[model samples]
Target: MGRILLPALTLICLIAARYLADQVGINGLPAPVGEWIDPLRLSEAAIWLCMAWVAKRAIEVALRRGRNGSDEERIPSIAFDFLGVLLFLVAIIAIAGLVFDQPVSGLLATSGILTGVVAFAVRDLIADIFTGIALAIERPIRIGDWIQFDEGTPQRTGRVVEMNWRAVRMVTVQGRTIVFPNNALSRRDFVNLSLPERHFRTVKRIVVDFSVPAERAADIIMSAIRATPGVVPSQKPLVLIDELVERGTVFSFHFWVPDYPKMFMIERQVVENVLHFLDQAGYAPSYPKLEADIAWQSVSEIDASFDLPDLLHRVPLFSKLSEEERLNLAHQSKEVQARAGQALVAEGDAGESLFVVLAGLAAVHKSVEGKLCRIGQVEPGQVFGEMSFLTGEPRSATVIAEIDSVFVEVERGAMQAIVRENPEIIDQMGEIQASRMNAQEIGDSTDGTRELDDPGFAEKLVKRIRLTFGQPG
Candidate 1:
């Protein structure tokens, strides 16, 4: 009803304007300076056309904002309507001037000279406008695109927020808005991170001491990445031995993420998971260690004794297990030893076991085209080989001992036996594993690390203990 009334009101205004214009005549005498400039020889039909043109333009603007139509359909229609308005006004004025015996040729010639001067003065502005038009047509960078400009020392990376006739605006990761001239952008080297696809590859580097073999570090990093959220397994990750630094070997793991907007969050998760895994595996990132001048004490003078049982009790996985359950699991878990430079597990090898590190450090590596590369290291208390154990598949990568290490090996049969003996334990384990696996499928790699600390698991374990003793769950 509003739309119909609007067009009706526009038609009435057009009729009034045209009626007044026809009364005044096309060659009317000039009025005083303060008087309004009245149209000469305006007709009802002409006035209606103008009113209809304006209404059409307003409707087009509303539709554009709604974003209901395709660019191909909407843009050209708007352009045509705009040009029609321009032509209508120009033709009306020229025709009126000619009907009144006024010289429009001279006016047009003067206007042309003025337009040329203005164009010359605003050459750069014109260039920017054309560039903007080109950008819109080519769509090198679209609205909401994540882009990085490689112009200066530190490249500017941001999400494109808006594009104007002369400039483009982007919001940086730090929440700063940057405006770049369209012409400048056209000439600059910029990468549309969200172009081609929304996915991007992010690389993380972990440097371990040279004493920790490179091959082992590579495997650890690769395994961590594969298990980490946001990493796409279809695009196999790469572990490159970047360089040999003075203190240690520097290695980088390059993995692909499907969403560029979530890159920062995913990278942080990967780093945290890698660090936690390395810490548990007894491997720490390499840094220069300070030497004390008075550190020549004999081996017999140093006390190395510590309570292993007390330390093990602090671990969350074992800490909550009942005494009998813990002892049972311990009995089923056999100690395996590996010396430095020894391969603990090889890539593409069959295994039906999982290892929990008890002491010492090991490196994880992956073989790419027959070349062994270091990814990262593992530390005590960390579990490895679970991938194959759970999936009943071959190992994707290899684990090698970086130092003389002791690890608790729980064979598949033993684990199955424990699960069968305690069905409740299996239920809890399944819940934890299922939740982590679901998160991985959705690219949330840190789900395993964070979700594993479920308080409900502890409560369930307590309830299970009570139930075994014929008490309430």
Candidate 2:
């Protein structure tokens, strides 16, 4: 686009020089033509220099702010720069012939062999430069895009951090910068991971014995996926029966993540949550009698080290149930654990599981106007997540583990199973939920928090609980 300036500048200078020379007689020279021509040549060169200055400014402005902040229009503008330089070189040759009176035809004739040698020597370099120009124009992969390609090949992988005339630079996931020749990049196949929303789907497979009913096992896996923070909820997770083998059935979990960089961390959390859920369901890995105990506890399972039944007995609400019943409830529970400072239940997260704190301490906090205010402390045997667990609503507060903690989570199905047998447990659970609302000394009462014990609060709480738990009102 800026190439027009070079020709326009040259034409104007030519007309002005011709007018000056014709109007002011040249025959009044004091000395020889060549000696005096040097001074006149300098003056002509000064006029050409002024034109070059204008062309330079025009080219710079057009390249910089022309379109999309320059990057989108980088290719065309750069091509203009290349063409302008070539034209300037041609002008230099003309100036030499006109001002110094050199042989214009002989110079071109003698330079043919030299030009061929230079082209042959820099053939690859020239190809790479032109190839870079082509890529800049086409923009198959722009800067800031993530890509992957064959190792040691011309194709580059990772994020494109640099794009220039000779090469494309990428910073790989491993923290290495790779500079690929532009010509080489043109010859290879690469995957551009930035297209189509940049959402990456990952598949995780788990093997389980035939004893676990397919539907039941799938539910356990799906629950873990739903709890995972990285899983994109917009794309529903898929649980598929991938294969059946002598060992057991292979279940594949396919989930989409918004960011691909956090894939490994998300997968780790899913695997841990799934394994914990499986462990609580009596899939303790043991292999003493593989054939005989295949349907029940077998050698293939890892024994869940946490004593869930004993822990459940420690809770006052479960005190009415017998040891056998506690064990049954424990088996139905999904074991969940969290590290210090990790949230077992985040405020505003939709939850269906009632978390019974089995070990360690936790801090309960409510977000008031975007600021977290500590509401209470949860000791062992205390239950949280009950609001969302029984009501099918979001969590009322965030519970973070004060230390490495353990929890036996009873989801809606497991809670329903227990309530179907014992409806009285609902009243006791309701009383506790009511107590939390009415309690005066929940942590940080110094903020002068008002008691939430409104009239008919317990009735409303029990009503919602009974409805969600499938009890007759």
Backbone clashes counted, model 1: 19
lDDT for each residue of candidate 1 in 1-473, tens digit (9 for 90 to 100): 35446656776777776666667764444677324543443443355455556656566567666765553223433233444566667655655474445587777787898999999999998888778777766778777778887642223888777777768888887788889988999998988888787787888887876544455466556556665667776787787999866656788889898866677787888788667656555467988757423333333332122223333343433454566666666566676877768988787789877677655566777776899877766565656665455445577667887655666776766555555566565445445444544444211111234344565654554454334334345
Model 1 stretches astray by more than 4 angstroms: 1-106, 150-155, 230-235, 258-261, 289-354, 357-473
Give all TM-scores, in the order shown.
Answer: 0.56, 0.56
lDDT of 2 by residue, 239-264 (tens): 89999776777899999877546776
Whole-model lDDT for model 2 versus the true structure?
0.69
Quantify all predictions' global Cα lDDT against the true fold.
0.63, 0.69
As a whole number from 0 to 100, the lDDT of residue 111 in candidate 2 is 93
Best by lDDT: 2
Candidate 2: give the clashing pairs.
284-301, 284-302, 285-301, 285-302, 286-298, 286-299, 286-300, 286-301, 287-299
